[model samples]
Target: MKHFPIFLAMEGQKLVLSGGGDAALAKLRLLMKTEARIEVFTADPAPVIVTWAGEDRLNLTARALQPGDVAGAVLFYAADEDAREDARTSAIARAEGALVNIVDNLADSQFITPAIVDRDPVTVAIGTEGAAPVLARAIKRDLEERLPVTLGALTRIGKRFRRAAEALPFGRKRRDFWADYYFTTGPRALAEDGPQGAEEALNTLLDTHLNAAPRAGHVALVGAGPGDPELLTLKARRALDEADVIIHDRLIAPEILELARREATLIDVGKEGFGPSTDQTRIAALMTRHARTGAQIVRLKSGDPAIYGRLDEELTALDAAGVGWSIIPGLTAASAAAASIGQSLTQRGRNSSLRILTGHDTKGFAEQDWAALARPGTAAAIYMAKRGARFLQGRLLMHGASPQTPVTIVENASRADQTVLQSCLATLAADLDRAEMSGPAILLYGLAPRAALAEIPQVPEAAHGP
Candidate 1:
């Protein structure tokens, strides 16, 4: 926050440097990659700089720092041991509206040179903001370890394909083709074969049809889990990887989507509260039509497809249409929520039965068998009860459930900001209001476990230190 980080584009600009020793030579070498017009001034230039100058590779002046030399320069560097000369050069350079760097004297310099990792066109600059140069170098080294040496070659491939990509008929088609090519073919060639591999991949992609019509396919109703990507079941991951087209809901996180094949078509069918929704019937029809064409379609839903999820309607549509499909179970939000709060839905003695219920019924809960939900020794897990907690609690109480039953409401379960509020069924509404919480909450009500009910300090009293 102290310093604003920005990447400045200085492809073709004038740069001035004073001194010709090792430090100055190093700076000049770094500048060689830039399309900058560099002017070097030194009473005694290093052999490397002298060699470059003799070979007409660099412009050099065998003279001391002068005020006129800073004019029209976008950047200036003073790498001399003379402190007074460095300060004078820095002042002149700044007055001339140029960024100045003084070697070994950061306090007097306007800018400090950063450790750089350059993959030619892709350069990463690591700056410590004048804190620790060694730290910057260490970070650069770490990045160098992860970044492959073939990245530059990959960039060159991209440059070679830029025109062909732009000339492609449709934007979406071009993007799809490139995305597929990058993952399926680009990585292998770049990793093992070098530039020849890249060239072959590009040639193969360019020669193929970029706008081929999608084939007919079957739709798999797959659950993507609550929020955590790691919670994705193996079947779910496999379904995603095999999907030719994926119609995913809002609750599915980006990480889960990333597992899908890069060529797969993705459509967002997010259902937000009080927001525009993709009609479930329409979604089913789309999936069915695509599946009939032999396209491997995936209807990506949040959590388990069978748990309060609209799998009944989708299945009905699929069955009526005679479209063959399968279901991939995912970790339900209720299960994830329970695990996050360190509680089990069905604990021996605490509750003998467990029931899951939906809070909002399109048809009012008047017809719902509330008595079954309120059965003694049964634990109820209510989904989508953010706005109807009081009404739900009242309905349960009126149907033979005890008002004193313990309840736990979990919000954003299994996520970084997950919160759990424990209270009695009678006080559930009040607690929810006090917490000022909203967004996809699940209610757990049953005979409270003695272990869960035990009071404990908010923070551990003792700090475990070495």
Candidate 2:
């Protein structure tokens, strides 16, 4: 790491800053939140700074930073636009034993200011180690959306109750108390009656939880949308954040998995198409086992769990074991694939209905109504189709599917590394092999990727001979 992250004790400390431009104002905006007494030195101070000083917001002086100006300062910012001035001011601050930051100068800065999401007492600071400020700001924005504005208020209330909660046993018991308060009781009370009601709710929660048995765990079957973490539904993300245990598929993206709670137990129950696989029974057993132990379990799947995800089998097992569970739908590969190609699954004057088919199943090479699927204007998205590409090609061709029918193979849909190969039904197998595509791909029949940046090779006009 280029720099270490530390939260300084700013109470009764001094913060020195220089400059009168936008940079100074930007730093001042965030620095105003700190408990430190702020001092600004500038030859020509901005009017806003003078007004702030008049209002007792900060101490402003109209002069260049002199020696001893940074005495006893915990932090200093040289926001001068001129490099020479910044260098000079930073030197004076450093001589006084204060950590100095030169605005926009990473190499010369002793510390970098992170993009911060402030909720008063609840603050989230994201740093890219002075590498990518834009990326850091994007992350901060995402967190701003995920976190509620009232979180700080709830945290403040929780802080007041910490003494009372200490009556409970430390470690797991205390953690459970906080968890229940934050996830359920606290939010519910705040919504129903506002912050004042939350206090009563917290007290009731403490009393009930302190006297009651430990919480019983439940299961959440969450669909981690096709590759891209941004495509994940709000509910799915919540399930991951609250999960005590995450049982994920092999195809689930690492970025998506990173969203899970840091302390959560992550189990890779990945099953391969024709390779090593986890037994279905074993997966269900794991779910029930974790739930029975009072752990909040999340069964994380790659795409929508309803389609070709063997969802019924797991649901049956959970039901038989008397386990409580809920499902969070995700954007299936089909929808993502369709989006990648800039086309809808069903279009006007084209296909009126859509079908989702699996390339293979427990019996191997899933059997479907090829005659119905081969009809003109029929649209279908075939999953697990990589290995069974040839089987699908032969069946569709034999069932009167036009050899010139448009086919688009979307690999790693909605991901940074996504690839789209456009071809005809006749050359689907050959095109897939030539592409050397390896990611989880979906095959689209009667659909072709629209004009985009991708260099899609044109399908031959003449159909290949059988």
Candidate 3:
């Protein structure tokens, strides 16, 4: 970020501006909203600038800025309407140790201003680091409409009542009380009986919550999608936001994990193919233990949890623990891989059915119906197939599969580092070896990247079968 967004206490700070035209007027209007003492310096003053000076809204100097003019100013603005003059005044302000902002000249500014949505104590700042002012303004407009004008009043009243509300236990209980007041009880009471009634409502609401039973723990088995944050379902996002304990798989993207609350406890129980991994029993135990503490737990898995994600085993464990749970499905890697290659898992004449397979199981390399899989027009998305390429190749070829049958390997599917390798059954193992793929990948049998079709060499008909 070119400028880190923060709210500064401007109650008694000095803010200097060097301009007399629209640019200066625009900045002054926003500055006046703050409690800062605004000072303007320009040789040729506009009518409104003079009016503001007369009203004592700001102290106006009828002359161009000189060296040390902004010596004690905390913030300086060079909105002089001319590039050369702005640069000169900006240099002066910088020399005087003031953070300078050159209007329309982002490269020369020390800090860039963000578009703001004002709801007093509940203000929202939207910035694009000087990349897209229009987009920032658009977001500001949207937020302004959504936030009620009464929000400021509610927040101010709630601020004074914070100490009184501390009588309830901290953490969830306290949070629940505030949530009810801000979202429900408080708003209803204020609309009917003004600010005084809102205070009465707060006291009444607190008493009810103080005597209520403690909240029960629950679990949400959420799917994070194929390494893409945007592909994650809204329900899954909400689970992350509210989750107190997040036990996620290693395959889940760092970006996806970033969506969770900063205070949330993140535990990585990653299980790599043919590598050291957290035992399934231990993962279940962690969920049950956290849930027993009345904590909201989220079992964040990559892709659709119901598909080959060992959903049944985890659900069985949760059932035994007597903890309630819900599932939020997401886009599987197979679907994302197909989309990346511009192919469908099922086609009208090529394949009528789609199958999802794993490269290995508890014992070793997983077994499949090789005879059927070797047939022409059959399609499958083989997950974790990178490490078992040779086993897959030998099995399919032994079942009379053509050496020329197209195969594609999609690595890091739906992610920024995604790569696609096009090969055939004869060279599937060899090509995968040469690629040196390190990320999670899916192997597509009887399919090739649509765009790379003409580029792939075809095998002779005589070599169709083993």
Q: After superposing candidate 1, which stretches have Cα over 4 Å from the reference?
A: 1-12, 17-32, 39-65, 76-91, 99-117, 122-143, 164-167, 176-181, 186-201, 210-332, 346-354, 366-378, 398-404, 414-417, 447-452, 456-466
lDDT tens digits, residues 306-424, model 1? 88778999899988998887898888988887787677888787477677877776664423577776665567777877677888878777776666667888887777777888887
The order of the candidates by TM-score, greatest first, is 3, 2, 1
User: How well does candidate 2 score on lDDT at residue 234?
Assistant: 94
Scored by Cα lDDT, where does model 1 land? 0.78
Error of 1 at 263 (Å): 15
Per-prediction TM-score: 0.65, 0.79, 0.92
Better of 1 and 2 by lDDT: 2
C-alpha RMSD of candidate 1: 8.0
How does model 2 fare in lDDT? Answer: 0.90
Where does model 2 exceed 4 Å of error?
1-6, 12-14, 18-32, 37-72, 80-82, 95-97, 104-107, 114-119, 124-154, 168-201, 347-352, 450-466
Q: Which 10 residues in a row give candidate 3 its minimum summed lDDT?
A: 457-466
lDDT of 3 at 222: 92
Best by TM-score: 3
Instruction: State the TM-score for model 3.
Output: 0.92
